[model samples]
Structures are given as C-alpha cells and as structure tokens.
Target: MLDDIDFKDYKKKDDIHGTVLYPAVMVAPVQKKILKDIISKNKIVSIFDPFHGSGTALYEAFEISPEIHLVGCDINPLANLITRVKLQGVSQFIFRDIKKIEDYIKKPDGIYEYSFPNIKKWFRPDITDSLALLRTAIMDITSDRNRLYFWYILLDVIRFNSNTRSSTYKLHIKENDKIESMQNTVIDMFLSAAKMNVNKFKHKSDNFILYKNDIFDIIKHFRKNTFDISITSPPYGENATTVPYGQFSMLSLYTIPEYDLELEGWELDNYSIIDNRSMGGSEKSISLTDFELSLIKDYLSLISIRKQKKVIRYFKDYFYFLRELCRVTKKYVVLTLGNRTVDRIEINLVEITKKFLEKNGYKNISSVMRNIPRKRTPRVTSNVYQKPVNSMNYEYVLIYEKNNVTPDREFS
Candidate 1:
C-alpha cells in the first residue's frame, strides 16, 4: 500500500481536470486530485483509457501535462463524441455562433410531428418537440466535429430536464412526478452546458484523439510499448444493471447516419484485432471461452440468483476485456476501481486486478486508498460483497509496473 505517500499542495485550478455534471459520469474532483498527484510523478509521453467513460481521465491527463498525447477508446459512440468535442472541437467562437443559430431559428410551430414512443412515455409532448427541434438544428451544421460538440451539450440537457431523481448515468428515475415545463428545462440545460464547454477549452491545442470502437480493436492498431501510461476505470462489474448506458445516450449517438447501429452490442464480437467483447443489451448470442466460462460460473454461484445473469455475463466480458488491455500497455497501468455485489456475494475488484497483473508478468508496486465522501448510497453489506461505504470499505488506486519486457515475444 502507498498509504504513507503524501500529496504535495497544488492549486485546485491547476490540479483539477475538466468538470462534468450532466449524465454524471466523470470522477469526483477530489478523486481527480489524488489521481493527479500520482500522475505528476512521471513524464508520460502518451496515455490511453480503455473505458473512457465521459473522457474524465483523459481530460485530467491533459490538465496534468498539456504536451502529453492522449488516446481514448470506448464502445459507446456518444461517449466518444463527447470526448472529441471536449478535446478537439470545443472553442469560444463555436458556442457564440451556436447561440446566434439558435436565436435565428425561432421555434417553429407544429415541429412536434415526429415522435418516439419511448421518449413520449417519459417526457411531455412539448419537451419532446423542443428536443427534436434542437436535434435537427445540430445536424444541420457543416462541420462534423462542430455538429458533434453541439449535440454533446444538447444531449446533456435530456436528463437534466427529466423529473428523474438521479442523473442519466443511472436509469432509475423518481416515479409518478411531472415537471411543469420540459421545453424550458431542456433549453436552459443546453445553453448552460454549451457555455461551460466553451469556457473550459478556450485555450486547448489539438493533440487528443477519440476512438469509437471496442477497447480491444482500438489497442490492436497501436504498436507494442506505444503508450507510457495506461490510466483508466473499467466498468464496475454487472452493477451496471442499475443503468443502461446505451439506451440513455442512443438519442444523441445516432444523430448521424454514418455511425453503425451494429455498434450497440459491440462487446460481443471477437474483433481479435481489437481485443474486447460487446456489452450491449442485444448481445445474447455472443460466446465465452473456458476460462471466462469458469469465472462466469463462479460469479453466478456467488450471486446465486437468476435475476442477475445478464450482468454476470457482462462482468465476464469485462474481465476478459482487461486481459486484452494489459497486452497493449507499456510500462505503467493504473486502475481506479471499486467492489460490488451480485446475487449477494461480494467481488473484490482491486484484488482481481492485482491477480491479473501477477499472471501477466506485472508486479504490484503501490496502492492508494481514498475515501469517497459523497457516495450517497449505503455501503453494500452481504457475505458475497461488502460495501466500501461499510466502515470497512473504500475505493482504491492500484498501480503496477511491468516485471519483464519480452522483446522476443512482443505482440505484433
């Protein structure tokens, strides 16, 4: 454990990464501070994030060092789009121009013709119509990147306007309540988000890239030892059942016709070149290997409930997915993860990661434990999985180093 290692003082503005409130996917500001502390130790040449949820880590990596190259990979096209917008497309002029565009195109009456039954089920007609109009306006932009940036902020408003108790990241909504004016809420959120992004990246230079593909496939294209740092947070086991990431952002990711609908279940394929499995809801047909099957069976036995089978399958997919990640990383691999329960059994995620490193010729050098003060939910308490919020539980930052470099066995 790196418990004794102390962080030196740094101004919050200098140490912090970009902030994300809508959809609520980025790591907390204090957590980023801890991560930045560790990141400052190395002069990283390049960095990679496999999951890239909301591009939180990549943004922080840039905040730590503007010169380091960054690459982010995610199966979620919406996440990729947002990552690109924050990194490459965002600028002050763009936001100002978008405001002018919105004002010029006054709300057209009877624009409520198109309908999504699912959207209407949750939102009032006026809200849905306003959203549709915003969607149309963003699509009309000439530059693909500029259009995507516009869409990212617009989508951020979707959940903000909802009466749902939680943010969009978790699908569970506060029930039986209606907001008085959905259209107004959506518009306010869109403008606020646009302004935030514009101010945040007003001085950014172009050195980051976003890949809308499975982690495995994206890493396959990189030569061995290509990156100096691999800092990421993989999915938190099957606990993801609480929220459906794809369904939440599908409205925005599909704004363009060029993006394939097939990417929805991307984790299922053996795109051997990419080294990842699909985590999409439509991936019932994908198969697993004997080793992975064993882990899945153990996961099922631990949880011992039929309701969690889908999540267990997704967990299995993520486990194998990490192995592929390790294959591509060069010197340091940093994983920020937490434990969770399935059925009723607890999964020690950090321990699992350590075991993986040991198996792949890596040695655990240090780990930092940080208190998650704002974790609103009760610590999970079951024999299978003990909640970190439980006086005994907390999040961990584990760092490992490659023990040996086998040049002869280098992967092509």
Candidate 2:
C-alpha cells in the first residue's frame, strides 16, 4: 500500500537539477519512487517512455539500475534534445568547452540579424542580439551531444529573459514596464544553468535509444513485448487549450537552428502547426458512444458543443496511444496522470484510464493519489467557456500488469 511508503522522507533536493533545466509538465522527483518500486517488483530488464518529456521516468530507471536498456520518443525536438542530454550525462571537459565558448561570444555592434514573425514582440532588441551571439557560439561546438546540452541551457536563458508571462504554460506577454525592467543577461543565465547541470552530472552506463519521431510512428520500430516495463505521464486533455507546450517552447525552437531540421522550414507564421500536430490536435470526429467509460459520457453531456468535440478528440488520440503502449509492454505499465476540468466539469482521467486498461487486458495492481508539491502548471483558476474552473491539485499514480490473454481489439 502507498500508505506504507514514506514519500516525504525520500525527497532528494538535488535530483531535480537535470530534469528541471527546461520546462514542461515534469514528473516530480519524489514520485519517481512509484515507478522505481514497480520496476523492482517486476524484475524489469528494459524500460520505455513514449512521451519522454525531459526523460524523468527513464532517468529514474537508470538511477535504480544503470544497466537497464532505455528507449524513449517525443514529437518535440526540444524535448528530444533535452532528454538526450540528461540521459547521456555530461563531463568536466564539456564544461570547459562551454566556458571557452562563453568567453568567445562578444556582443555584436548592431542588431543581430535573425527573423521570426514575433521576434520583436517577445524579446527586447538588445536581448535578441545577445541570444543570437550565444546561439552562434553554441552552434560552433563539435560534438552533437555537447551542443545539445548547451542548447538546453540556451532554452532556459530564452525563457527567463523573455517578456512572456512565467506564471502560465500558455504564451502571454507581461506588461511593457515589467518586460523592460527585467535585467538578466543571456550570457549570465546560460553560464549559471550550464554550471549547475555540470556540477550535478553523474556518469551512467545505460544504453539510451531516443527517437525524435512521434510516438505513433516510433512504436512500429519495436516488436511486440519488446519492453519489460512502460512508464510515462502522457499529455492530459486538449493540449492546445490546456498546456500549449509548443507555444511555451516556440521562442526556443525559433532561436535554435538544430530544431529546424525536424521542423522542416518552419516559420513563425505556421506556429499553430506544432499544437495542431499534438496528441489532441487531430480533427477527426469520434462518436461519444465509442468511449465505454461512464465518466467520459457524464462529462461530455456537461461540456459545451465545441468542448465536447475537443474532449472526444483528445480521448480518441489517447486511446490509440494507450493501445500502442499495451502492444510494446511485456508485463507492467505505470502511468501518472492528473484529472483536469473542462466547462466547470471535472474529468476523471484516471478512472477512465483504468477502465480502458482493464478492457485492453491489463489487471489493476494499485492506484494512489499523491499531492503535487511542486509542478510547472499554473495554480490559478482557468477560464473554460467563460466560466472559471480550478486546475488539478493532485495526480494519480496507476499501476497495471499485462494479462496473458489477448485484448479485444487489435492494436494495429
């Protein structure tokens, strides 16, 4: 039982160093024990994270047993880049190179020439020039892995120095005075983030195989039952309205050239494409009757017509993702998910997920609710259909074991 597990005392302050360097909804360090405990019980030899945001779950797996093989995939280039660096680990030599590169970046005489549609809106002219200098220096690094690490640092620099409101994941600008008064230089923020990461870096021997493709596409590369355990916290509800991960990351994605390869001639004008391609972004209509879960039906009835479609779309994509997750896992699956609200209606995602897993031939082992002491999500109430609704304060840690019987539906 979770009551017997002392999560409070197990807290490690330094564990967050590498994971929190770049922002997304991250799995807390203390909560990692839930996954670690499951891995220990199953005698797991391999681990996989389909939505490998910052590689927290896989990182915990490596921390538990460094010899375990790790596989992860995310559609976001920045996410892939950050996770790759965290798993690969850094060396003192890389820090030395970063220091040298830092010294080499001198302020340009004129505005650093770069064009993104909202460049002037998000950042000050001087700040943009400083960021361009850092970008150039980081690009000069010879090693792909090391360059990625520095790019992650630059991501932090961009986020901190920008005019974007820090309180929420969705992009919104602060007041002009507030933006103008901010004084942190790009070089200082980059060096600070890099130094902290370098000091905390721990060398590991795990085999990390990461893919920059969508989860739906990457699942095909693995044969059935390739992974012993699958652990992840997938995006909850509609990503466009709820999280806006792509918008939060747009500044960094636009500034960093390495991201351009995956983006394929991405311009600021097509920024909506990122959110549009996210999990719930598919517009294909799903019948409300298609979902067997009662909670989904109840919520669908309460939400507005537009919101009902959004909910249906999110669940449809999630169902397909879950099917693929079951396909690749041999034994255990651990999921950490938050129940969010839409149109003043609380969506019990955890309960719905449990029902879905049971229908798909997995037996529920345990489900525990844990308080989120710290997270990237805003604490304020969100406006849904012009009605104010509070965000999720707690999350569910659900564990399930794959049954030997075949599922009712084919994953393919």
Candidate 3:
C-alpha cells in the first residue's frame, strides 16, 4: 500500500521542508502519510528517529498528530539544532525577532564574532564579515526559539555564499572565478529564507524533545517500549565517503556561536571531527559473528581487503544502534534506505538492515521500493556513494513489526 502512495508530486504543500539544506532528508509527504497510517491504527503514537537527519520524520509526525510526543536525537549538532527549532515551533515573538534581525542587518554594529581554522579557505573575508553580522543578528534575538529558527534558515545561506562547491557534501573549494563572483550581501538571502519560513510554524507545538548526543547516550536513558514507532533514515555509509552530513553542516556550524549549538567544547576541533565521530568514522574493527559477516560476505568478496574492514565495522556499529532501537520501540520500526554504492558495488543496505532487524525480534511486514523522483543531491535521484554516478534508481521503505520472540543479547 505504501508503494501505491505516490510521492512523486509532493510539492511541499507547505514551505517548511526546504528551510535548511541537510545532506539527506526523508520525503516529507511520504513520511507524513506513513505516520498518518500508523496513527490511524493506534490511538496515541509516540515517535522517535535515532538518526533524525534534518528532523524530517519527526516534523512530519508532529504535523500529522500535533499532541503526540515526538522524540529524536543525532550526533550532528546541526541536526539537533534544526530538529529542536523545528519542533520548538514559531514563537509568539517571531515577528519581533525578524524585525530585530532586519534592524541589525541595516547597521550590523556587532563585531566579527567567529574564528575557526582555515575560515578564510571556505569563506571570503567580506563574506565572513557579512555572515558574522548576520550571525550576530540571529544571536541577538530575544527568544531562543526565534533565534533558533533564524539560525535554521541561515544554514543554506552559509552554503550558498561559501567558497565550497555546493555540488558536493565535501568541502571542496569552488573555482576562483566562482568564488570571486559570490554574493557579498548575504542578508538578502537570509531575509528571503526567513520570510519564506516565517509563517509556516504558526501553531507552536511543544510536544517534542531533541538531543544532540550519540544514539546510545540517548537510548540508555530511555526505558524499554518508550515509543510506539521509530522512523528514521540512518546513514548509508561512513561519513567520509558517504553523505558527509557533518561536512555539509560545517559551514553553518562555524558561523553560529558555540553557546547556541550547546557544544561540549570539542565538536569543532577540526573540520572532520564530527564526520570522524559519525557511525562508521572509526577505523577500529569490531568482532562480527560468522552469521553477521555472512550477510555481507558476497559484497565483501569483490571489495578490496583494506576496504572490507571499514565496511564490516560500519555495519557492526549500525547493529549496535538497531539492537537498542529494537529494545525501545513498542510497535514498529520504519526505515528509509537508499542504494548508495558502498565500495563501487551498489550495496543493498535495505536487505541487510532487514536481516539485522529480524535478528532483533522484528519481522519485515511491509517493504516498498519507490523511485526517488526528486533529490536535492546532485541529481533528481539518490546519490552514488563515494563516487557520484547517474544510475541510482530506487529507495526502499521498510516497516518491521515487533514479534513475540525476544532476540538474544549475545552480540555485545
């Protein structure tokens, strides 16, 4: 039935979906429909997205049923900020906050407020000055919720004005000519984004909590069966070779104040810190079972011996999350997976995740493979991991129902 629900023309009937540019996001309309179906079956449905990329699923869950509790977390600070601001909703003082920014942008009396290593490499001097002024304006807003909304809108503006190539998630520099021609007056772009998104969050919803911590850190505090459903699109591959969400978010992260991001003081230590800390960022290998290794064995055979360790460890780390996920959700786990090639081979993460979930007491009740008709990535389809290509075709949406069997917690 999910396959029958065509998301090809989900024109974002509301303008909220595109306020920020995250590397990978769930299809808003499709996610809403999925939540609606689940909510229809159950009287009260609480939702959680461990990865919470862009907070798309959580926002959709909030929209479909405003009163239901929605919980989400991500290791990416930018993601947590976006999710928090989104679920925080537009404050009553939104207009006052916009006016505050408008007034500050006119004079920009605040001094340059940010500095990170090689800031000049990604942002020009004038662009940094301009961004610093805008960042000051966002920080000056009276309310944290409104301030967060402006910060959420500022992300794309930073990406747009940065010297980094907007084409890729990596921090590759743009051509000199392109850099020279970049926008110096970034306030116009920021203001435009603010206006587009200003009125969308008119109904303030406070029924959500967001965390900017590792999945385990958040899950350890949650009791068993804390959520009715968990919907998320976990990272397809290691951040270095995959979507690089941390890299994609770095420009904006650097521009915002550390206090606003609720930093633990070392998240911005280097350009790759967040990526290096992501799911498969670790180079260390974990012990995998013969049964677990058997799942990806065929793909590992053709992949280089050195690359095999990275692939093996990524899944093992992912399994750790799935095991905890199975413990928390009471009813269903909804996952949206893509066909990004892991090491030049189109990896079937959906099938692999299905097996992993089954090992944790869930049965794949519904599986839907649909064409990704529109993507903000390089093309209208999903990305070709590591190496960009033009042949990506389908994204699998899987729904797993909790079964009576309790999985053995033998693989710690």
Cα lDDT, all candidates = 0.58, 0.73, 0.79
Q: Per-residue lDDT tens digits of candidate 2, residues 112-178?
A: 3576877899899889878877777777777666777788777878988998888777678999999
Error of 2 at 318 (Å): 1.1
Q: How close is candidate 3 to the true structure, as a TM-score?
A: 0.91
TM-score of each: 0.74, 0.88, 0.91
- RMSD of every prediction: 6.7, 4.7, 4.8
Which portions of model 3 miss their true places by more than 4 Å? 108-110, 283-286, 376-392, 404-412
Q: Where does model 2 exceed 4 Å of error?
A: 4-13, 16-24, 28-31, 106-112, 202-206, 259-269, 284-295, 384-387, 404-412
* Model 1 ranges with Cα > 4 A deviation: 1-43, 107-114, 143-145, 167-177, 180-183, 239-243, 254-316, 376-393, 404-412
Q: Between candidates 2 and 3, which one is better according to lDDT? A: 3
lDDT for each residue of candidate 3 in 1-412, tens digit (9 for 90 to 100): 3756556667754557767777777788778877777677665558888999788998888888888998888999999888787777778878877888899888777565688788989889898888888887787787878888888888888888889986677889999998998767588988877877777777667788877887756787888988989999988888887778887888788778887896767788888999888898885445667777888899989888887888887878877777789899998899988766645676788888888888878887678887877554554333435555543456778988788633232111
Could you give the candidate ranking by TM-score, starting with the highest?
Answer: 3, 2, 1
Predicted candidate 1 versus true structure: per-residue lDDT over 295-366, tens digit per residue: 446556655456456655665566556666676778777777676555555566677667767777687767
Cα RMSD for predicted model 2: 4.7
Candidate 1 is scored at a TM of 0.74
